[model samples]
Target: MKYKYILFDADDTLLDFGKAEWFALNKTLEDIKFNCNKYIAEKFSSICDKLWHEFKLDEPLNRYVQINYHDLYYKYSVERFKDLKELLDINISAQLLSEKYLNSFSECGFLVKGAENVCKQLSLQYKIFVVTNGLSHVQKSRIGNSKIKSYITDILISEDAGCAKPGKEFFDYSIKSLGTSNLSEMLIVGDSIITDIFGGNEYGIDTCLFNSKRKINKLKIQPKFEIRELNELLGILRI
Candidate 1:
């Protein structure tokens, strides 16, 4: 199927979020007068990943509480730091640490190996939009400093959408912003099956799974297309 609009996920899709997260986590820990080791940082990653998955679930299996709409990103992100603080038995304020992490992460513009090439090449033929479950300022700052910033047509963040991936409200905002009623003419590509593939499939649009790490898609969901590399996308789209 031909696609005029290609919505890409920022973290783990184009941006090297893992490295950026490591850098940010270390910086945040340092701010608290603590040094971060691989184990400590990985623990933080695990905690945040679980919280992110919960954020995407329909009922948030583990969290049955009412959703907090105000400062959605801050609410969701600070919770991860709260969990991390408890695990580390730290006295530092979770809110302050989370803010520091965001500030540090915003300075990161590290791209995946072929990200610039893919975005640069695809921008010529397709309307490229970054669809992310992230803080607006952090994402914008990271992208703005990157070379592909010029290639990106725009960005849609959950903070702005007031909803996140795997949720219909977010997809509704995305579709309307894309200004295209034809689902067949659009595609959503990302490394996540839950957010990108499952969400796109549920929304009646084509989905492409970018499995760069070769992780197993344990979920029942499947994407319409899959590629192991960003450059491989050029071949799939016949660019």
Candidate 2:
């Protein structure tokens, strides 16, 4: 096989993080005696998604959650909660809300459609690792509780590596930790163009974009392979 190892992004790529976040955020808001609705969940996800993308690029973001640090550690997530509190006019502290949201989130784990079957099939011939940018405990609990957990060789999270994706430091740390120098033998598959595709491209490895959303108009860089579904990988790998 040309590729001996596969680095897959967890959220959206394999796990249904949208569903997890919706349930967790609603539960957290309800816990604080706030009316939880779809609008609130949508707004919250927008804020968080922007903050994280900005943080990854080391850009100053929303005033409430802006930080000089680039790591997507728990502290950064707490800052995000601050943004959430300010926007939603919540009475609770950011730290308190962060705790509530994370606790609720960790308990909610659901795979993207075909994720389990895809991972199981790929594991038969290649080393598959979940390369993700997320809070350590949250990623651990979510992934550990999922059915795909058995197929994954390991979950490589940004918090544990001290750097997130789209940066050379993160790729450097991940590659070294994986004990591999031949970049050609590995492939990166993910939903995020910036994080997974860009990072893998910069690292000189083949990248496959799981464009489940099919929004391809804004791609700054092109990946080596593209698939609309996990099952398509069977043809790519000649499995």
Candidate 3:
């Protein structure tokens, strides 16, 4: 009952991002006339996961697209195309592939069970916002397609804000946007310990780890609360 603002992570916390990502990536592979054999698709996904992990750590703004494509090419063994122009062409193709994935991903309106109900319930008592580390256009489209859009007060994407999660600047931007100076009255709910939990802790806000998959380890950075289901949040908030 102490928190008046609830900031949520968009991807896995509310959206069923893993399923959406799989569908989008498979669609992209098919569109590019690539053999999307199950094995190949899984391998490409692994490559993407690694690149995203690195991006999260390095926080390089300019190399976002380049790093993804570089990892894709290396993972798919496309480096044999030695001509610089050929490599560039391949990069363009990969970019298009990823763009399609993002586009399709935005259209997929898959939400985790209880996400809508919980958001709606919380909306009555708290100011709710989405804080996500994704491209502005894509994140906007996804929220627009979701049922919880009406319940959320604001959507903050890293691209438009010029900062990503786990950065103090990103949390500061979110706090500023909420029109509040008190950090104790805000709570951040997210799935990633490295980003959302850590970022919220750094910003001196309470945090809830949405560990739906029960995969998080006992980390040094402790979240104020943990819930395996979104519905549990209503009880935590005494809604």
Higher-lDDT candidate of 2 and 3: 2
- The candidate 2 region of ten consecutive residues with least summed lDDT is 59-68
TM-score for every candidate vs. truth?
0.84, 0.85, 0.81
Assess the local accuracy of residue 227 in candidate 3 as a C-alpha lDDT between 0 and 100: 96
Rank all candidate structures by their lDDT, best first, as comma-separated numbers.
1, 2, 3
Q: Per-model C-alpha lDDT, please?
A: 0.84, 0.82, 0.75
Off by over 4 Å in 2: 46-76, 79-90, 217-220
Candidate 1 minimal-lDDT segment of 10 residues: 58-67
Backbone clashes, candidate 2: 0
- Which residue pairs come into collision in candidate 1? none
Which of 1 and 3 is the better model by TM-score? 1
Q: Per-residue alpha-carbon lDDT of model 2 for 1-239, expressed as tens digits? A: 69999899989999898899888898998988898887877788788877767665343222222222334446667888898899888888999998899899998779999888888899999999988877779888998989988888888887677666766666887888778899989999998887788779888989999999998547568999999998888789988
**lDDT (Cα, tens digit) per residue for candidate 3, span 21-47:** 777766765666654566755666566
Better of 1 and 3 by lDDT: 1
| Candidate 2: Cα lDDT at 45 | 75
Q: What is the C-alpha lDDT profile of model 1 across 1-239, one tens digit per residue?
A: 37999999999999998888888889888877898998998798788878866764333212222123325446768999999999999988888888899999998999998999999999999999999877788999999988899999999987678776766777888989988799999989899887789888988989999999999888888898999999999999999
Model 1 residue 113 lDDT score? 83
